[model samples]
Target chain A: MPQCSNCQFQNMPGTTHCGRCGASLLLATALIDVHPPRATRWSKTWRKSRFWHIWHSLNHLSADLARRVDVSYPSSWPSILAAVRLIVPGWPQLAGSKVNLGRFLLGGYLSCGLLAAVCYGTTIGSFFIAVAITIHSIGLYDVAQSSSKVRAVRISRILLGCGLIGLFLYLPLFNLVPQYAAPFAIRVNREPLRVGDVLLSNRNAYVWARPRVGDIVLYELNPVRVPAFEQGRNAVLNLAGQRVDRVLAVPGQSIVCDGRTLTVDGQPSPHRPLNLTFSSLQVSLIVPPDHYFIIPSGERIDGLLPNNENIVRTLSLIPITQIEGRVYWRNYPWSRMGRIR
Target chain B: MARFRKLELGKGLPGDSNPDGPSGNEQAGCLELAVEQRRCGNYENALRLYSRALEDDKSLVTGWLGQVQMLIMLDESVEAELWSRKALELFPGNGDLLAGRAQAFRRMGDKGQALLLSDGALKSAGQSAYRWMVRGELMIVIGQETHLHCFDKAVQIDQDWLVPLEIALIYRDLGAPSRALGRIRRTVELAPDRYYAWFVQGQVERDLGLEAAAIKSWRHCLELCHGHVDAERELAQLEAGGWSVGRVWRRLFGNR
Candidate 1:
């Protein structure tokens, strides 16, 4: 039954306009929302067709379209573009520009999977490659069916650019990208150290042992309680706090900072050659099992600051188990970025 | 050492224990499915669908109570209690919803609060056998001198109660086996069709050393109450030929 959007009234399903208020009955006739809330804005482009769902999926759920729990309705083109975003990811934001990002992922995945399978001789990789090929073929078909270059350019640019980027990512200088990515930190002097900076640990760096003394290490400080039922399960703990410091003490070692001097394992730590290591304040810290002690360059010179503003000349030994994948490069603010030594 | 697992009660959900589901566009159709699921005791899947439907639209109250019942089944009282509050925000004067919340509070060891909520629900004419049963449970956990009163209330509210007969047996702690038997017999006189009556009758007969009669009554309860876990366990223990008068006495009174 068709209902009027303005007044609470129902009529025959075929009715296009309200009998009394003359309000557009198209939403009811086409969309079948017989009891639409009067407060919400009504869409005028209602058509009672079998393909109504396709239109709804495209427009209502588009990533490019902003969700308004108020007086707004999605336009036809945006809706179509929205649904295309899901099937061809990155399409909504990248649709108009001359870049086609679509070409790389689907084809790149297949190529990578095939190469992995050939190199590793794993059937698991082959199956993954097959799924990639299938998606790529679907993407290829979609591109060919596109009526205009503007509609397809985003997919094409993505392919060429991504393939080029992927091909060069593991190479030499290009690896120095993370320094530009996260721009919160700044480096001073010869120490590849930056204050107000948080570094992502290179998990792969310490494959055999922990990060050594004077080597800045990144570790998560988030406190997450793992239930007894899930003690050893892989948990993606979010970082609660962040600090970058060089290793000062490891397991079976102790540290006591006293009046601008530091002691590791009951002896003064080596601080002369590294001019930046000037932090000295008296506080004894024990290095627990499977943990690392990292001391920062700032602390190496300025003793422990009460407010935690002065970088510690000494930091706790980071646990080997508390490691995440290494972030080796930065790539934000093109002017001041380099390898996070 | 096996740590004593806590006792749980009531499947208090919104989509459950209600004729109409939460409000939605397809409410009428969805509610009918919920009703069918409830009758068939396919409460788990019915609950999942109700919650999913609610997620699609929080305005839908059908899944709210359905979630309550599912939580009761899952032994999740805290979550069920939270959901009851959500359901109440929509249906202010809803008696069933109030009773469901009361059951959640009871599960969390807040018997005093649970009793008050149950009383409120009953005053609002949520006077079904289920509400009365909840009241009976509140009395047992809060204080058990009201066993007869609660059992009678449950039976009076719904004459054919399978629950009252079972609740009466908790009187073994009061050192009155005969009184428990009397309560069970009364339950049978009122609700002959209920499997609980027959099962309680079997236990009484077993207490009185009538093993053959006990077996007969228990088997009959099993016939009526398919997948009755407690009854099945009892029957299996008896069938193993290890059960005797001495064993039964020790088993029932060992802890006491």
Candidate 2:
């Protein structure tokens, strides 16, 4: 029986036309050859190049391994590709053909990252960064689950994958997050930074810029032995720790403070140490080239010492290197949460 | 009123000729039945029969080959590959078994291994239609121009209508409808009585965008094999305005 190519109406073997559609039965079958074009001279030369040789070898090696494992599952290749693209959250999901989930994850990841960057030195920024990392980790796990050939993935492989991703994320973020913003808790009562108050300090605040006057700076102090009235006994207390203070004078400036009134190079200065009462009636100093004049917060050191001149001088001049960071924002005690003035 | 006939004890009823229970030709009968079931596209039934035949005679290479081929047709390529390896260990360097394994690998998406095993099949001995068909499929996968020549060689080796039909199916599966049409035309001309050939012709024509031709082909197929569900569904889909939006989307983007 001969079937019409146009209408597929069966007819006699020797018929010239279809009985139903009236189309010709003897039409030649059009052969559409899909043979690839012959290699050109440039292509031939490129195929012999070192890079191409390496690529070809790698291709052969991977094909051999795939054959050995019999990786024939429908999602195997996509899963593998997704694993490789795990650097970007939701990229693996997209590669593995989970389009909607991938898009949602990618959008969330990017939005969180943008927010973290925008709110770089705040508590909310840290929260956003944590959220972004969590999204990325979830994407990785999803890709791994989808790619696994067995229903129950091997415990060791899962652990290894997670460990590697954890290390990759931890290494950079461990250094980066603190450099931008680090949390500090006030231990003693100060005017603005009272006990139990949590604040954030920008550790990289003075990396490229100099600390200016009126900026509240956190700096380390040398050990000072101060007499303490503990249990009705005169006991010495070693004070060697970090302190937050206000910079009243920068390099090449002179500051004079008499009890309550203060002067910076013959002009009255508005910046004052919070909750501090100076014991010395006349205290004057010239800020050096690489130092700043800062009034340490809390009880004045002169009031605690019998001979307080040495301790005062030690506390007044703050070297640039010893300045740790700038106090930026108060995060805890929601009622008082705001930027530190 | 009807009376019941009396039953005999030693001598059974008139149609009960075989006095003995099991015969020596049981394994051969199983293989024959398996072939018939395979020809009818009952791959599961054929696989069961093939397994029965293998149990009776473990050394039967044809039974092993039949089982492997049935598994591949049933889309159990992993099992097929494993069984092929076990069979290969029993009958080392068997060309037909090698060709069967190559087909399994091809189904499993390992074209590189398929091509390698196909080459080994051709190199081993006994030129058969199956080995040539595997080579043609490998060529098609790699986009070689000589695929048509390989299919021609397969048809030349065996003039059975099943050969061209299988080739057409391979071409269809690999997304070469035009090439499949040429082989399907040969198949229909060779076996006009085979309803499946007409059904496949309808599918190929539909793939080529010849809606009228596909309808006529499906109608002819239904005439030969009445109440065929696949043919009826295809005809209904065509009559109801083919290519729904979702269908088109799946066709364009689905893994298939």
Candidate 3:
């Protein structure tokens, strides 16, 4: 047992510093037990460089590599992963080659882009496809080993990409999807729409109703001239991830947003007022018949009404018809991003 | 504060203005929405978004535009004009700024200068279709000398319905359906995607006493465009078999 010479922290034998405050515990031999030992404090838990954590991770990786490094791989493990190293889905069961990965990726990119172009055209769909294919190509690059098998797959992918491009070229002639699909679908541009979440009014939605609070909706704005993903990113998913916010407010529901707080019909939601500007907000709307003003949690404030001639004026009044659609899912972050709460 | 994390986006007004940092139109997106907020007369919101958007792409055009518009909406047009000028300096030949300036001039009762500046804009932007269209509109309102030149140029460039669109409007106002019909017919070809073109075609058919054709045109417009109040009324009239003079007047001007 050793007590820190400078501090009251007592430590076990051979302990160099006070577990509590890094004080020298080398000189004073004293009682080891002070209080019932609680789990080591957060700061004391890893006093030294967490080399063990790194060592553990590295060890796991080493084990994985060792497991794969077979003395006789082809003969022993007839596993999916082992097979995958040589081949991919929907490919001929020929002698699997390492080089095929690059070709597959190239093919995927070209095909996807071509298909998207054929389906959507250059303005919206083509551009998106091109970006998406490029993303898949990166993974393919990692697998290419310049073997003959890789060459064959590359050729196949190129053939597929060309077919897709050809389709795009003749899109109008072979238009598959109509101008509009499903007379009226409850599609929310904002996925994982929260219970009280609102989204940006998609200019592409309904004929009459202006978007209002209490309406869970799909928000799809007009195709931006320069899309968020375009020009700034090289990845298709990155481009697709751009989104607009939606709010849900109910009409005649004394909606109040007081700076950093909100109350909708006297019920405080999970979302609060954003204190950007208190003077311009008004969230009092009379929910139109058959339509709820779908308000995201924080859009209204006290004394903030839609007709008040301020930023929040729209929040004050919402027609039933303006409700676009309810939010159902969130497709980001993978973990926390799921169905709207 | 935790609650505000979720509501922050909801509170933001569309348009914002950031007059100092950069160009707005170049940035693109909600980042450029501040100018729209100003256009919609939400000044306080315009200011907030402008500040935020400026943080992203400082040289956003709409940010400055929003700021200027907000200043103007707040009855500080002088400051607004200064901000507008700064944005103009960034873009140099921005149609939006020119339009904003023209509006500012009109508000300030400087009609002569406003018209002159607008004219200069039209002449300088003789190659641009949107400019020509804007100029044609100004000329039509005041019967300026550049009307025929601007209108003809706009038509020559693409005529993609816009040129014929103007001609149709002119003829409609002049009570000349015969001429308007020719222009609208071309407009329909140029912009098949536009419901107004179809509606205009229906209008011409109605004026010519071709009830069946008018009904067909209206129905097609309604089918293609969807939720057109004018098409709805016209279809209703045809269904009822009793179209009135009042309805006609509203159809021609008010409903349109």
Candidate 4:
């Protein structure tokens, strides 16, 4: 007869599932007693063997360690090992014999982590990373609870284990997300911001401080309609993307430019366009409120719309809300790694 | 030591034989000796004997059942459950093996499963004192008043002194020392020479606060089983007047 591990039902011979409880009998194995029987001559001889001596020694070591740790019944070295196995999220759950939940958590954590990695630096990636962290945290809590039957021991273990995990794993990722601090790789060559130089941007910089002249800023470009010749008819093309540039003028300042030389409030400005080359031009305007004059990076606005004042105004003036972050450090290309000027 | 003896309740004495005694055969003698060892509270020895008997004769259902019962007595409920399943494989639908598995489940705290298995045991082919006793234990676990009727049915099925002794042991464990005293006294009357009975009787008397009767019972138990460590310990504790406030509180209302 095969016994159902779930309900302990004794089914007839050769039964695949339990007749009473319908639990599958194929995977059910009988529980074996680990305690040795009373010592007899045969048993004594067996105990004297090298295998028995090692096993006995290991048991004693685990018991001693458990006692030293104040972990009572069910908190042997195996349970502690299970708690430590939280590195893989669901490994501890599997060690604690929660097979179904362990598999689900492991699958979820791995899948979410893989997706987050594949879609790194996007909103979707951050969402997946958050989900993965939540799953890992749940696994940690589960392992801690299963580590001991004592309430105080379980709670203490949960706090200590979760605290360490949060410190090492969650905290760094939490700080990185939500525009706290973000890494950006410079793809185009712009002086001081060369290609392959990775910059760290403090997204929270302008939260309390105002954007000042000479500060490198990361800002989103609003879509603009540009005339395009398509299929022999004039078509409107939408152009939008992000750009990193230096602030040349602040709000309420008067900016005057004659092609190359730039002046702000009747004085020559120290800031130069980071992406655009010096050219002959004539422009004079008062910086609008809540807007900063930023040099467009490598954009030939005059050539795109010759003599179009609207294009120059739209390209030069950036709103305060558009300022995404302050570039603080150039982190990549080992030789040039330092705080951004 | 007293706790161990309270469970035994002289139910393991050699003379209080199992009603399902071994059949007259070559391996019967080994099984009979195993039964005697089990009666004498030497469950490990009894288990080894049963294994030896099974090695010689695999068809002997009693040998398998005895192994399972001994494991349960030794508080190896997991081994009992496994062994019972293995035995059931050989003798499928055997009522006694089902009851043994039920007892294992009960000890393992699976009361619902235990009740389910016990019901199957009762409806199976053969009826035995062990099966009724398991049902009675299940009843007691559920706080049913009909537990006594179930135990009485077990006693009626098997006239051995072991039946009442085991019933008294169960009663005492469930914190009904008053009810246990009657059954234990009957056990002592039936088996006067069994020192384990007097030991259990003393434990029940002590639980009821009958210090004088408990002392007398322990003395008699020591005389029958000379140098019995548990009996001597009980007498020593009594002589030293070691009843503490906590012990008194436990005696009065700990069961509740």
Candidate 5:
């Protein structure tokens, strides 16, 4: 069935005009299949091929691994290998007949190399090191191949690659690895973090030191500790994931958030007061042993907290056991990136 | 069937600022494609197409509306406000633009400004269903008791499934899952194949603790629109068997 482009009315198949509106349905054909199902066998293969294309662009072995079964078992291994070579480095004579994989591969290699270098230079040290090593090996192999290119051209390419690679590797060698690693990179999806911004948390920063008031920490939410009512209502409350929040108080402290003002241990705290969009939540408790009270970094924290009283109570004082790491830096959006206070 | 509703769309709010129907050229085609993309939740692509459409025909009110609506969905209320004000400059006293500006103000937490703008929008809205829906949403945000009546008016203007869907969502947010469920049931009856209706039904059922029913509704939603993200997430949570008391205790007591 086609949907009316003008009125959005779903019309019967083969109808010249919308049943509800008299608009011609000719243009409605494009709107009929908005989201095609991806579970089909053809789509699965297409997805796999797309993944292979990315891996191939990076010159990673994963692409080769993906093709090994078809390559190794094929009766035309020699022809296939030759085809692969020609497809990647299509001669100018075959420009119209063949895909210019050579241009694509070169572009992909340089971009991926730059990305991996930046990733390593920032905080993703281990993963980028492995990627850097793999790409360098591929570069060295290209330089070694006599059939590939002129000696001068290969040497210059390798030198450029080596220079960029060395710059990235220098940080790790000098004990200058970034203080935090951003394993959770989706903080930009929320407020305070703009698109292209990345959050970096130090897993060991709080291990030796005590987390104090005003520190943003990553903590795990234990659903079981959440009251049964909340778990039944919204299952995400208990889902295991590292969440970032500002620590409000520690053990033996009394805290109060009156929707407008927040006071801790009889002193007014310096922080934005909660927005009273929902029912005002009031909590005053002696922080129990091994518990830390943390609040999310948003003006309106109502939807951020679970609805059940027991869950809210449990969340109000996060057990030290659930504390994962301390968020310390905004690593991306270079213009605004800096140490998070 | 009554499922087919007479729609005087893109005309109700702000008195049809675009007196010219459309250039009926490539720009109109682009606008149509942009609307299709927006409806499908392909926001980034829709934005690009909307901009293209606007570049060719700046007077196209729907293009401006789509841009403002997409900005709101992206949680960029500041940008939404800027764009709405720009549209208002071109089409002054346009009700849709005024309502869209109200939405941006509401999101920015300025309830007073939002209410004033929304009230002004209602005066010029005439019978625009989308404008009435926006007014109803603002009413809910301001905690007004007449929000439901606004939603009713929206539905009364045009019996589109979207009006009911919007009403159901508001009810769900107000902690009245039963009411949401009732409205969503009517939406499903009106548009049985609409994935969003089933998805909202599943949500209301989940809130009501009807796990089995929720799962059934979500499964149907996925069947209708395969790989729907929300439905997929809901199904995964249900399949994971939820949290147990012992497991929670272990997490709370275990030292990392």
Candidate 6:
């Protein structure tokens, strides 16, 4: 069965058009992952790889190490009680909500994973990891208890349900969707955009209007092509794309960077050069229609502008078509979670 | 250093410099084969052969250069820079390495370092057209007025069609569509059947506001390379904008 790209409705094999919407089904047929099965694809690929062998090897090694260490469980009851004791703060709220224990445990697990993912790129990794592990232990205790209704459900089904929920949460969180509205982590500590600031980009926002000057946008490029320190510090958070930048000039705008300041249409604009050198000082150009001059916010210049513009477009200016979306909002670090512009 | 010295004397490393074994010429032979593969658009195979060549003789400068060149073509600039730096550690001050690193830096968006390295490359040992091309790009980055001279020098050194195509792109960025069109015309003359030439020609024409001509060029490009994404997109955009009244209405009161 081929899934329609438009409506996502399953269509008959060899169908040229979608049955629901009459849209072309070519893209769906050509790309099998358009509507991938929940877990079948993973199991199939796992069977092909040496995953089981590696897993068994690790399992045996861990078992041998456990035997050598002679570390006992030290009463599973104490561990369970300790885990429950940790979650006592939330028990009152859980009791008042009338939600099932399974649902509550699932919520705790999700919130922890989300927090860990959101903080993974930051300096406080250990804090998030600890919180997540504690929550995970609590969830495990809930499942192990015979009195809890969650323990009555099959472990495999519970795991599958939790896995699916996690996957759904991750898709939008990681901007994996073709049309995604998500948060972006600011890697460069520039004037306007500080490191660890989370910005929200609506990838589908520019469907009608052209991007204007002064619009801070989340555009993409080949990260391997963008210049940065080789020590992996200042490494792009998104391996597939460049960092966030502001649009200084839109299509058909005459712009010049004379190594000191930017001039848009003969007047000196407030935007100043951040990175420049003697051998590569100035650049003046008319922004071609369907293209935009996107530069990181600060006194520094993007390395692509002065030299490699011809080789890679995203170095200085980017095609409007390549823009993921406008960075309309910032939604993280609590202190800066509002309209970005 | 002694290992490198022994290798230089053609007397060490299995499958490397040992004259009585697989000879140092194999590295050169592998590089040539990789270059041929790259020319034929077999980039992955070229990369693999370049890597194999480098493993056999780590001191092979051309092998490193070829590998980095292929990586750059594949848009793997980070890997290219890493590889270039590794080669530079072993063969510091080599002109090609300096120039290659300069290119990697330029792509990485470090123009200041790129310019300094490009200057060093030009002074130290770069006589090749590729070296001159890198200089031209660096010159443009530095706000030099006569950057075109560097490109002209590159063309003078080697009349490969790629140099002109790059030069035309520079001119296009500089907002001189006429000059870009002139250079791209030369590119088309040099390689008539090349779809990329036609595609670029269409872009130049579009910039010049010659929509019909742009459409014709893009159509020619599509005929050459069927389903070319850029050409197809450009064609669709042109067709969409053809209805002036509807476009004006949409602009006046939102398409939605």
- CAPRI-wise, candidate 6 is incorrect
lDDT of 5 at A40: 39
**Residue by residue across A1-341, what tens digits does model 1's lDDT show?**
86543444687778766675454544321322111111111221232233644664454344234544222653422243333453442343233221245545444655765564332213443466556555544443444335335645556644643353335432332355333222234344324454423333454676765555555455543342221223676443222345454466667788776647778887888733133445444456677777765543432224224324222322334566654334444332334334554
Ranking by lDDT: 4, 2, 6, 5, 1, 3
lDDT of 2 by residue, A119-182 (tens): 5545786799899888887776776676566755644455666687777766777778777668
- The lowest-lDDT stretch of 10 consecutive residues in candidate 2 chain B is B13-22
Tens digit of per-residue lDDT, candidate 2, span B15-76: 23444421447667777888877765677788877766665455566777888888777766
lDDT tens per residue, model 3, A1-341 = 77543334468888766575454443222222111111134423442237634754564455456556654564432333332332332221112222255455556656776666434422345466656545443443333323225566666644544354345533543343322221122233323333323222233344554544433354332221121233566322111112223454543455555435567778875542222243334444444544443332222232433334433333323344444444444332234434442
Chain A TM-score for each candidate, in the given order? 0.33, 0.62, 0.29, 0.50, 0.46, 0.43
The C-alpha lDDT values of all candidates are 0.53, 0.74, 0.49, 0.75, 0.63, 0.64
Model 6 chain B, poorest ten-residue lDDT window?
B12-21
User: What is the DockQ (computed on Cα atoms) for candidate 6?
Assistant: 0.01
Query: Mind giving the per-residue lDDT tens digits that candidate 4 earns over A1-341?
Result: 76655446788898877676454565422232322233245644655478865765674466456556655645343344444466688876653436569889999999999887655555576799889989988887787776578888778877787788888767876776647658787676656577777677889989999899999899977667767667899777665677788899999999988777899999998788665573444678899999999866564344454355676678778999999999876656657767776
Name the candidate, 4 or 5, with the larger DockQ value: 4
TM-score of each: 0.33, 0.43, 0.27, 0.42, 0.37, 0.36
lDDT of 1 by residue, B42-86 (tens): 555566666545543544434666677556544556556766765
Interface residue Cα RMSD of candidate 2 after superposition: 21.8
Candidate 5 runs further than 4 Å off: A1-341, B1-26, B37-48, B170-178, B241-256
Can you list each candidate's DockQ? 0.01, 0.01, 0.00, 0.02, 0.01, 0.01
Per-residue C-alpha lDDT of model 5 across residues A1-341, encoded as one tens digit per residue: 87654456688899876676464655322222111111234533543466744643454343344457555565522232333333222221122211234344445555665676455334554565565455444533443343235776556645654564456554464344344463446533445654456677777777688888878777885543332335358433333355677787888988876655678898897743121133355666678888987654432345444355565566567888788788887656567667776
Candidate 3 structure lDDT:
0.49
* lDDT for residue B21 in candidate 6, whole number 0-100: 27
Greater TM-score among 1 and 4 belongs to 4
On a 0 to 1 DockQ scale, where is model 2?
A: 0.01
In model 3, what is the error at residue A6, expressed in angstroms?
Answer: 68
Candidates' RMSD to native: 22.5, 19.2, 39.2, 19.2, 30.5, 34.8
